[model samples]
Target: MHVEWRGRIVVDPELHHGEPCIRRTRIPVSVIISSLADGISEEELLEQYPKLTREDIRAALAYGAELLQPKSI
Candidate 1:
């Protein structure tokens, strides 16, 4: 599952106070991650956020995973 999260996620200081969000949408990556963590299904997510796609959901997962990687000095 090699998802290109960079293209799906965006950080704009003018949007959501600079929170990382799905491109062209105000929904934060954290919200999507949290919803999934809380047992929300992909289909359910799509219904909840009609603006999001399956790829966007996957991208959110990928982005979150990338953040957990150990940073090098």
Candidate 2:
């Protein structure tokens, strides 16, 4: 089974140990976020992950931001 998040991100147990990744690619969201945090520019990221787009990067960021939000219980 395949699960999609933020349109461009996906989570599949068969892939990357179910870590959220870019749809159709095994690149995990955490890697993308970490790369950006480590001073890797968007251009560099694009070069490194050709399958990803600006929209995909933005979606990953949005996903990360949502995860950081406090849940209302």
Candidate 3:
């Protein structure tokens, strides 16, 4: 299944060298994803990045998952 990433997730040349990131912040989506991979819970994520919401993290993960999918020929 493919998830449509919208809102907080955005890609901008000025942000993280064009890496996907939270729309208004310099934080890269990879940082969020890696934290989750390392067993950081949503609450911990929120605690670390006070401005980040659960939805933002979910969107980042969905975007990452979409990137990992095989492209159809």
As for model 2, its CA RMSD to the true structure in angstroms is 4.9
Question: Best to worst by lDDT, what's the order?
Answer: 1, 2, 3
For each candidate in the order shown, give its overall lDDT on alpha carbons: 0.96, 0.88, 0.85
Which runs in model 2 stand beyond 4 Å of their true positions? 1-5
C-alpha-based local distance difference test score of model 1:
0.96
Tens-digit lDDT string for candidate 1 (1-73): 5779999999999999999999999999999999999999999999999999999999999999999999999
Off by over 4 Å in 3: 1-3
**lDDT (10s digit) by residue, model 2, range 1-73:** 2222567988899999999999989889999999999999999999999999888888888888888989999
Deviating ranges (above 4 Å) for candidate 1: none
lDDT of each residue in 1-73, candidate 3, tens digit only: 5456787788888778899898777778999999989998989989988888777888899989888989999
Best prediction by TM-score: 1
Find the candidate with the highest lDDT and give its number. Answer: 1
Model 2: residue 20 alpha-carbon error in angstroms: 0.4
Range of the 10 consecutive residues with the lowest summed lDDT in candidate 3: 1-10
